[model samples]
Target: MNQWSGVNALCYYLAYILEIYLGFSQSIALILASVAFTQYAVFSWPPYFYIDRIGRRRTVIWSSVGCAACMAIIAGCLLNSSYTTSAVAVAFMFLFLDCFTMGILPVSWSYSAEVQPLRVRNKATAVGVFSHWMSNFVVVMVTPIGLNSIGGNYFWIWAIICASFVPLTYFFGVETSGRSLEQIDQMFFEHPRWLMGVEADCTKVVKQTAEDEEMRHKAYAKYDGFDQKEKHVEVVHHEEAK
Candidate 1:
């Protein structure tokens, strides 16, 4: 989570930092930042609609792969000293923004919200936000210093971070795309394995709940009749005694 969140948070700052390290003009930096932001805004939500259709886990996994690849390419561009490397790096930066916004940005929040029970969801979401911001804070603080110290090599660390997310997501990611919140809760209740990637059956759960309610209603009606009969028998017996 921090891997992508931190990268997304600190990436804009890189526009200015790169001006110094890569010796690019401020005009070019501003243009790159503008283009990246525009692409981010345009591509972010459209792909999100497909999250349910294609499944959340697959979207995130594939997007993470794209982000890692972009980071690697950006790092390689930085290592090269040709004039064309600047343009290529800018292109990869745009790719990074697209990939991050499309998958990591929305999934991080939605996935956290879906996995938690309704009773504690607000508090859990708060914690999730805090963790996310804390990661951003750390990255924001460390990035400029790291960029100065390591130059282009720092991006390889981010590439590795992005790559590591793929397996972690595949192993532990719960598919909540078509499942209800209660069904997700039950999934965790029944199988507490954090590493198990399972999709919930909300239809079956809802059907079973309705069946249980119907059975309870019938039992209550029968019990009510039995109580009334007992009361009538007691009344008759009391009058005979009198």
Candidate 2:
């Protein structure tokens, strides 16, 4: 996020300088840009097409590439001396930014619902969400200071972070598209860092949750009041004739 948003920061800083240089109404341009962004909101859920078809790993990988491309293009345009170069760069950068909602990172909660087993899935998801938001909080607080201090070279800095995630995804990310808990467990068992604190037994933990969910469902069905009540029939006992 730091690097991804760093591109936007670059656009803003560049836009500020460009506005002063161009002497055209930048405030109006900014307003127009915001309106252009509304188009993205208008056609919401473009990722809905691929989230189920391509799976989380592919979606994340593709979006990671997108963030990289967006930053790189912005950097290239800014590096040029011509004002036209910078303007085109800003336009393209904003276009890409608007489309970022279609990225896999935003739809992760949906992925968790599709992937995790039921019993302890809620617990696992809660922990995962906690870690994600905690990291987001830390990154958002620190990023502005980092970008301001670094100056123009910060675009490259953001590029490096986005680039780093691609390899990490390739090496560590599993294909959870159509796979079940047991398959996910196999993926985890292959890598211990995946589970955190529990080490080797985390695979077992995943499997146990799957089993628990299955057992709970069966138990609930067995005890369903309407069906069970019907199952019970009154039996009259006749005393032996004396």
The most accurate candidate by TM-score is 1
Return the clash pairs for model 1, or none. Answer: none
lDDT for 207 (candidate 1): 27
Q: Which stretches of candidate 1 lie over 4 Å from their true place?
A: 2-6, 198-242
Consecutive 10-residue window with the lowest summed lDDT within model 1: 199-208
Residue 83 lDDT in model 1?
Answer: 69
Total residue pair clashes for candidate 2: 0
- Over 1-242, each residue of candidate 2 has an lDDT whose tens digit, in order, gives 42243434443444453453333368855665565556546534677666656656556667767777776666666555366875676565665564355664454556565456666788888977786667666555655665457533456666666666666555655556545566666655566575232333321222234576688668778879657666553222222332
Error of 2 at 197 (Å): 21
Candidate 1 TM-score over all chains jointly: 0.78
What tens digits encode model 1's per-residue C-alpha lDDT throughout 69-187? 98888888878746688778877877888888888777887889998889999999999898888777778778878777887777888888888889887777877776667668987
lDDT of 1: 0.75
Cα distance off (Å), candidate 2, residue 37 = 3.1
Alpha-carbon error at 17 in model 1, in Å?
3.9
